[model samples]
Target: MSSDAPVDARAPGQKTFFGHPRALSTLFLTEMWERFSFYGMRAILVLYLTASVAEDGLGISESTANAVYGTYNAMVYLMALPGGWVADRLLGARRSVLWGGVVIAAGHYVMAIPARWSVFAGMTLIVLGTGLLKPNISTMVGGLYDRDSPRRDAGFSIFYMGINLGAFIAPLITGFLGEKVNWHLGFGAAAIGMTFGVLQYVLGRRNLGDTGDRPADPLLGADRRRALTRIGVAVLVLLLVLAVLAVADLFTVNTVVNSLTIATVVITIGYFARIITDREISSTERSRMKAYLWLFVFAAAFWLIYDQAGSVLNLFAADRTDRDVLGFTFPASWLQSVNPILIIIGAPLAALLWLRLGHRVSTPVKFAVGLVLNGLSFVLMAAAAQAAVGGDLVSPWWLVAVYAIQVAGELSLSPVGLSATTKLAPVKYASQMMGLWFLATAVGDAVGGQVARLAETWPEPTYFLAFGLASVALGLGAVMFTRHISRLMAGIH
Candidate 1:
């Protein structure tokens, strides 16, 4: 696991392609099944919430459902902070992933139970579990190779493809089952997928070896003790606040959950600030870290638009799109797969395009391009929304086209941002810095949900326009700062 050790860039029994380790397959399958479970649950969650009570749903209003969707998705990303912390400081990524899988499995099983209370409890557990698993698993992937290893980017691409493969399939299966048969059955299937992921990780332990274990630094133990103590105090204070809010009738369960989530976000931001501003970090590294923080904020805008595939877009598919195809109708839920489908097809082409333009574009320029494309996708959707006026169902092709454009944007930004973070993060705090990167994603998700909720208060066209214009503006701003940011990443890569 030493940085100098040569990677086994081959299939288990075949020749290597692009110098990536064969052990990547183990990580790939594990992530694939985990995403299958996650996306499957996501495809059905909004529909389940807004469907009729007679159908065993929450029967919430559209705005409320979107709010719930936004909050849940936000919490999922926010949890990654603690998940990474636990992995880096206490349990190590391997054990944390194992335990996270267990928690997620249990949560999904709870969702499969036939009660409103079960739904609440199950979703909470799943959010917490995801926080623990997502960041740690990603950190482990970076661990598998040395810094600036030529294979790193390609390995991440292959790994991301696995994520899309699971995502592409999940919505089709879960969406159909949830809409056509029973919602809980779809959740049950998701739980089963998680079980498979857990099993794969357990069986593939040797492939990971000591890559994700605790660092050998003697100071590591003291840091872990301090972190755990702070976490414990925070949890206690959160519980006390929840109790007070409930007694005052100012907090339903959802309100308490939202407050805790917001608190977690604030605390995480404070933690990163403390680390970056500390005198211990060299001045040069501090400048690079500041650049990373800026990139994170810009990347958050991309996620805000992209993640709508699960929340606002899901609702649009269910309510406004033409689901009928050749005399057979497809479930609106299945449309959620469109983004991943496009990603699977467009990723290679996007990669080639980047290679061709390597000398012409900086990472920030590519990110700006991504943001603009993502913004345009929403504008296209806005046009579709206008066409769907007077209760008409717009052609499904419109949704497909939007997802295709959005995927193109994703290819330009998401993977590149990940690479940039690792390269720029100081070696001593790499895992924690990556955790902050994921936290930006959490913030974007929360903001997306809020945007969706606000849009729910307006006409469809207005909502689309708002999101589209804001995304374009964000992209333009990022491009303006590209030169300054590039200077910060100087000498890192």
Candidate 2:
């Protein structure tokens, strides 16, 4: 279940499917299709970029491609800030999600064109569309049940499962189209998925009632006009700046990556400072804030390690690892599906473990465990590297094993971490903490790209071993300091 699923949006005495609200079906399908489109496009993006020009690709260097990939991923999370604001103050969640899907479909169609500018324009539109859609869509799922309803968590769990179902299937369909037929076809498939999602949501809108028909905090008429005008001006300025950069060739790979890296660090530090200095919070809350700062650190490290499943790890599957089975070679993009598959299988078991052992296990302890598991995945990658060093193709199980362990770490860290943030959040800063969580993810992706680029500097075994050990050391350090962080958490588990 998504811990971020808002409790305030509950529906009462509502009709249900299987004891949960009937509206969940529509919302679930919408999210499922949206994720399918998003992950489907993502599954093939970097591969298309790095493929040779002869193969209808841009033929960019690996380092540059990694930087672009990282920057794009980071932008998605960062954009959520403005996205949520826009939904709350201007367009209600319904309109935002509806238009977001339309924009996304248009983006995909743009990508289907053969021009390089189409790729850039398509990705930009998708990012903008996701910003509008991603933050607002699942919010309605939270509103599907009454506040006191016991089924709310179950509904969110089912909703979460639906999203992952699409994630698991995306690579199979899009990856096959991208790797076998045409990359543009893969993008087109994503567009088709979004179109279906939009249609479903439209048909099912009546079930939603007035859940997101109006903004929670409505703006006055003049203020609304002013806000919209400012928004338009900001967007126009941004476009003009981007156009200038592209025309001048100032949109270099390093410039993009370095800018995001700096932005992440500065914003992260500023958020920490704001929390620590806030006078309205209690001393204990401040202590917990300090502790979450540390959590933020490990969170970044964990994502830095985990996100490689799509970057360096994907490349490894394509190059070093053997994909052949009885002369039918597997598509490299198919490997992108493994983590989501494991998460779908593992999340419930982990949730149960936490329920059974919530008090016995501390938040810091879980973080430590998650960190260690992520570290161990890289260690397995190192082992894989060693096996393939002699120029023999390694077993596909090597990459599969790494993804399995990493998914375990994700199960421990991701959802659990979200829950912990909500519980530990200061009264005035609850939403801010959620944004901070997104910021950590943004930082992780930006830094992860730079780290992936360094794979070129060292031999495979050394590269894997070095980062792997760093993670293990961090995990052990987190374990050793568990009691201290527990103290700082002020009784939060």
Question: How many clashes in candidate 1?
Answer: 1
Q: Model 1 residue 452 lDDT? A: 74
TM-score of 1: 0.90
Per-candidate TM-scores read: 0.90, 0.94
Per-residue accuracy of model 1 over 196-260 as CA lDDT, tens digit each: 99998888776665666663232366776887788899999988976887789987745754664
| Model 1 misplacement above 4 A | 1-22, 146-149, 213-231, 257-261, 268-272, 487-493
Q: What is candidate 2's lDDT per residue for 1-493, written digit by digit as tens?
A: 3322333333576666666656778888999999999889888888888889888888888777777777677777777767777777888778888988898889988998887778778988988888888878766676656666777788889989988999999999999998889889998999899899999999998777677666656677999899989989988998897789889999876876787778877877887898899898999999999899889899999988887777788778888978888998878999899878988999899999999995898888889888999999998899999999878899988988899999889888998788888888999887557777887888888888888888766798888889998998999999999999999998888
Residue 456 accuracy (lDDT) in model 1: 72
Candidate 2 Cα deviation (angstroms), residue 101 = 1.8
Prediction 2 TM-score vs. true: 0.94
